[model samples]
Target chain A: MTTAPGSDRSDGLRLSGISKVLGGRTIVEKMELQVSPGELLCLLGPSGCGKTTTLRMIGGFLNPDAGRLTINGVDHTHSKPERRPTAMVFQNYALWPHMSVAKNIGFGLKVRKLSADKIRQKVDWALDLLGLQHHRETMPARISGGEQQRVALARALVLEPEVLLMDEPLSNLDAKLRVQVRETIREIQQRLGITTVFVTHDQEEALSIADRIAVMNNGRIEQLAAPAELYARPRTTFVAGFIGTMNTLDVGPAGGGVPLDDGALLPCDTFSGAAGDVCWIRPEDLQITEADHAGSVRAVVLRVIPRGHYREVLLQSHGSTLRAFTDGEPDVEQIVGLRATNALVYADDALVQDDEPARPGRAVRAVADSGDRG
Target chain B: MTATDTAPAAPAAPDKPVTPSSGARSPRRWSMLFMASPPVLLVLVFVGIPIVIGIAFTLGYTGGLNSIASMLSVSVYTANGWMPSLAAYGNVLSSERFRSDLGVTIWVTVLTVAIVLVLAWCIALYARLSGGRLGKMLSGIAIIPLFIPVVIGAYAIRQFYLNTGFLVSLGRQFGIQLPSWSYHTPGIVIGQVWVSLPFAVLLISSGLAAVPNALIDAARDAGASLGRSVWSVMVPMTTIPTVIVATFTAVGVMGSFTVPYMIGPTSPNMLGVTLQATFVAYLRPQDAQVIAVVLFVLAAGIGALYVWANARASRSSAVQL
Candidate 1:
């Protein structure tokens, strides 16, 4: 979706050095985040990673021990939740069980004390926008889960808040329904162009919907980048392992390059700072071939798992297990040779460098021929 | 393990059928039946039998359509029969004494219930807002009255109202004498409220707790003020429990005999005190029974109304959820 020119220039929200200490534990450390106008940022993390705490602080449900929150360049750090120009959709929907769908949608407008006719008009408009016009008179419990989710979304959207905060809004749905409902949410959010911060632990949900994903760990943002950037160029070992599958290899310096225990000399970029080493190669980066292929390390195939488009081979080599994905099936119990076009070296759980030469390596050669398939 | 092995052996012996006699009743079912029997029997005895007896008494010998027929006939009352007893009701209704007493009872009941409900809600809200140590302390303090006997509470209030009582003595030091409990309705109302406030607070507090914290956060995020959140969301969501509490409070106040009997003045009396006076002071069993029946009907009607209103509110509220 394309935005109108100059729309992205607005400073939607900025959280500066936010920190929270609850029950003698640092629930949210000094965190910083900036959301541009018309961008949907997902605060992706596992439970207890402080994503929800950060969202609550921004929404004014909580006061940070030390921080300033600025929205549209206006500091609203100590403002009450009611005074903040943000609406939240809770995980359980949190639709007022005592109000009709129209009333629930128009609750914010009513609290603002709009005239009855105006509230009626706005309520009708919101219900229509959510395709809930027919269920306007129905109670929240009378509606289906998906419809309730829409009511929650409509209730937040009707206020036309500058920022929308959602806390695992689709976690309550079944697998099939979660995908369906998230698509609806994404469409509505994009159409409205409201800057939103969605908190979720599901990696796929975050990657599929967020304009930018903030992978949080231990009350801190480990890495924040565009979805593709996060997946392809993860800055830290945590990000790489957390984002997708990888096969880690232990290596140490041998001859002029790092040598795996299996006696394979893998060239490395000297600037990578890899020492006393461990290196990680993504499974898909590994190419499996029949035995006797030159420049390839031989390993015995342990098992083959069919993964739809590709087969994942678990191989035992030099007392270590290495997983590699290949398009063609390799015979089990047969010695197979594996070669990785690219690998990331890590020392003590920190990514040190890519295992490709800065000047000349297999990755460079492949890029020259096929423009780098991965 | 043994049971599984025996199951296959039973099947192997096709001549022996799987019968209720062959398989002993599951111990689990036996325990469940044992657990269920006491309450069933208790309800049958305490609730069931009394209702049946009351209905029988209402329709049969004690008083039925016959009682109304007897009242209609003048032949039964030639300076005898039920004349003097029926005259007592007429005399009580017409007299200024009756007017004052009835007014006193109505005002006392109203004031007591109002004070109790308001105080209970405030305490409950305070408990809900305060967490950890302070919340626990406040909740513990709120129910302290429950552990104290009703007579003790009445006596405490009585002592507080006496001329030499703490507040009264302090007032006298400032040269302002406080009125005694005998002359004040507030004293009785306070005592009644104190006796009943804990129960109401407990009920309402549990109801408040039942309201999802998410809904409160949602309402606040949607621009609702604290007061608006309470009225629009919290109270409505807890309408059933609140009605239940209020009904209990009303019925309790209507049937209250101890607090008022101990502290109420001699000149103006509540229905409970009046009912006691008819039975004890006047030694009039029939008149007391009639008044007792009236009080029962009033309390029962209020209780029924509360249940009906609560059920209706719950039904409407359930649809919203």
Candidate 2:
């Protein structure tokens, strides 16, 4: 249930060449991105990837040392947080402790100098919308974590901000409550038709909620694409490994149609890349068969992980580990034939400069390590 | 990581059983009181007993029952022939000089408390926002007064404002004639503020520290200006501590003697200095007792406010928990 591309709509929020340096280290460097109106874009990354810092700059908590921030084609790069048309849902759910839930939700309207009647009406509407009528007069600290989260959301929503920025809003929730609240947040964003930028480290959270996901690494956006596209075809190894479970297998040489590490050579028509390329295969793309088969290699099963709908089979062959997904649980130490249904080759940038003889196992490890760095 | 984990089918219900802690609460209550007795006894002996004795003295019960009876009888004969007399209280309240002294004391207390609260809040807010080396230095300087002996501090303030003191001397060097402030109400207030400021600053800083930075950021994100955030968010969140600072500063200023005695005007000084004069200079211990009782009642009023605010703070927190 995601909206289509932003080309049909006006630009809601944009950041061009935004950079921030803290204590002589560049936290965010020359970052450029945009979001369309009525879109939920998730900045998916590991910690220290500058997602929160970017959100802060958009929210006007921190000024960018370079570049500009624009909302609706207007530059607000140096505007104060109060002057910016944005609101944030902090990770800690920073609800005012002394205020009742209703008052906390009404704070933004009151700050805008609205009449008491208007504030009351809007606050009541928000309270009803978030199903917080039962806790209208309850102090935030007296409520459950999920209810507090709803109050934090209502507090921002009442302002009708141009851009709603959420920083790991669901990280504080328990696993079960997380999914419940996640649905609530998504429903509200769509219902309000507001532009939203959500920063999170959970790929599942992004995949489930975002209209588009921007995978970040080392304070840079690696790729930005729809969830389906990002999963099917990742532009970088970091994106492939970070977006979902990906298995890397080594490929030998640039000619002779490329040889696989499992002693099988196939015509390389699916992928074209520089020398010293590695194959990135999703676990679901690999097939397992009987002990001996043509165009397949024999491998001993290492372990099986049951994932309800499917089992993930971990295999060891020629000192390299390979993973495959199947409906059956292959017994440990059982011999099996492995074949690739689909695979995308990526250039091994780190090993290309070494000039050493290509060890298929080492190439796989290097690609996996680079993905881990992201 | 599979999602399909479920509990087994329930069996037939059984009768409820009494919990061990629930049954043990009766005996635990006595042990709780036992644990609390030491501090309770210390407060009774050091604080409660002294207050009782002082009140008794103020009520004309000096040594024995015979002396107390004679004193009360004489007071009754002089006043309205009542068994218990209000003669001393009546006299102290009616005295013109004592009335003026009381006024001065009230004004000084109000002014000092206002000054201390405003300045301390500003300092605390500055430190909280800056959070740099300069902020650290300012906080350190603010707390330095707490370590200085009150007498020494009072003397230092007295010297600084005297005709030949550092301030007047500095003014002379700048070719500006300055008036001496020693033995004046302004000088006394300055000294009292210096002495009382550190406590207010500490309490205010602690309160500001207790509020998470995220709350302030949230306020700003919600479109609150700096002043609006401070008044609507920061100040309200720190109500308990601000009230505490007010109560402590008011009580301390009302009962303080050294600062005013060293720097206040002799004619219309605080009741603390007058109380001292009434007891030692005039040798009127009965009058001093009456004045002291008035002072105690005033301080007790502020103490009651503090206790109420503290109770509300704790009760709300308990409800939250």
Candidate 3:
């Protein structure tokens, strides 16, 4: 059999209009996404948001009802998982309980009928890469959860697959182990430069590990961009609320902008279809001050919680309650004022869809101004 | 912890150091004795006593070593009121008819167990993979044969093998002819297989269900071929139940009376039929009892072998776990 050329390093894995129907219910709608090569793309969504289903479709475990999946330039929608050069690490690890770590890692090579000596060499290399050589001969059950996860990664990587698909692989781990293992996974993916698609409901996991995060909601992609970019300039209200902490405000139209409930006119560049309302500001964007800063709005400090490195201040402004992440603890008993500048405004639960492409310079200016001022 | 500290310990303290009244001691001891007596008495009366009696019987008497010694001697039969019955052993071993009958019984048992297991595994696999209304219907269909009386099953199988029956009619329609059922060994095997297949399938299906789905998916994801997945994972995982089913089927086939009796001809008589003929037709209860005892020993040996193998296999799996 002629070996297929490596498509792993080529950027732009395009999923064009993919949909899936299962048990008479539409699981994944017409979804489209393009993940750059060497990019750790995470599909972040709540449970049953079709995140796992979309991953399975890409893995070829389930065939999409209608779609074209192309990695680099190769159309692989109909290919089997083994033939597609994709290796998946399941949430539960799904390591072969009957096989030793070495055997589990060497399984793909063995299936391909590699020489026994070559298989041993590759298996050893993979185990060493994962720092699991000491547990090479140990069965999966004999190892710790972290070690089992490492074994799973080693098994997937041994084949040198072009794409790595992870479905909540760290969720089974304890809280502490989850962070450690997730970091390890990110490091390994970066080092290998594999085109990885990670699926998780944990927003922190997606934001921390992924080069780009694709926020999914109701069987459709809400936004796809760099982790920080998506967080800072979320294209939809769902992405804004889902990715990070946000405080929504209800406002009515006033002076070509929106008037807050407290009768402050906030200048908004765009308006949602629903004319009378807009959601404003993220927690980190707001700052507590002795006096209102430039373009800062006044708010009452309701509750202040000291959270180790930062203090979370909940404030009420214009009949809407907002939370602010302050560097130091603010006066809780005294009536303190807070102001948020350069806040992103959302209409309903979605970002205002603009007809014109966003001006990058203006977006950067907005974010910089919002940085410390709240 | 708080609840425990708050509760009074006075009731529990009284039991720790008992200044026991004689009245309390007698009732407490008697109650304890009463509770323990039934199970102990049952064991002695049933298991312990029978085992002692069986050992005594095997040793050839209820009494002394002289009786055992005399029982072992050639002249013991002549000395005692019991007749010289060495002929019974000779008749069982030397007679070509008896040897043929034993061979037929063994052949039937082996063939029946083999066929039953194969068919059962197929049914079990179908039931597992296609678990829906259709699967339930197929499962119900498989059990239909079990509900049929063994005599009726035997008769139906014999009829199906006959020249004018369904098999012959179907064969005739397809321009083929079948052999008559009168003396067919294969027919006996088929009947036994049919009767035993449901139990095998039910046992094996339950075993197959216990195999973790994660294991199957792991094997598939690791690139094991479909056939290899079934053999390496499914079959190995369900081996214990399969062996159990096979053992039961084997023992059942070996001792089956109705199917072989109703369908098997006189010339190629099975051991059960032969034993029946000896006892009922020839008025030889003593000889029949000897054959019956031999059959019992053989079945018990097969069962023991299965139990031994099952234990070894289970121990290996447990060790792996």
Task: Identify the candidate with maximal TM-score.
Answer: 2
RMSD of each: 7.3, 7.8, 6.8
Q: Which candidate ranks first by DockQ, i.e. highest?
A: 2
* Candidate 2 residue lDDT tens string, A210-316: 99999998879998999998887787778888878977766634332334454444222234233546766688877787765544556789999999999999997
Rank candidates by lDDT, best first: 2, 1, 3
* lDDT value, candidate 3, whole model: 0.75
DockQ of each: 0.63, 0.71, 0.32
lDDT of 2: 0.82
Question: C-alpha displacement of A175 in model 1, angstroms?
Answer: 1.2
lDDT of 1 by residue, A220-304 (tens): 9999999998887667788888888977666643333335564545333342443436667778777777664554555789999
User: In model 1, which regions exceed 4 Å deviation?
Assistant: A1-9, A250-276, A330-334, A347-350, A353-374, B1-99, B313-321
**Colliding pairs, model 1:** A141-B321
True contacts kept of 2: 0.98
lDDT tens digits, residues B59-101, model 1? 2223453355335323221224332235434544576755676
Which stretch of 10 consecutive residues in model 1 chain B shows the poorest summed lDDT? B75-84
Worst 10 residues of 1 chain A by lDDT: A365-374
Q: Can you write out model 3's per-residue Cα lDDT over A35-79, one digit (the tens) per residue?
A: 877888999999889999998888777889998888776788877
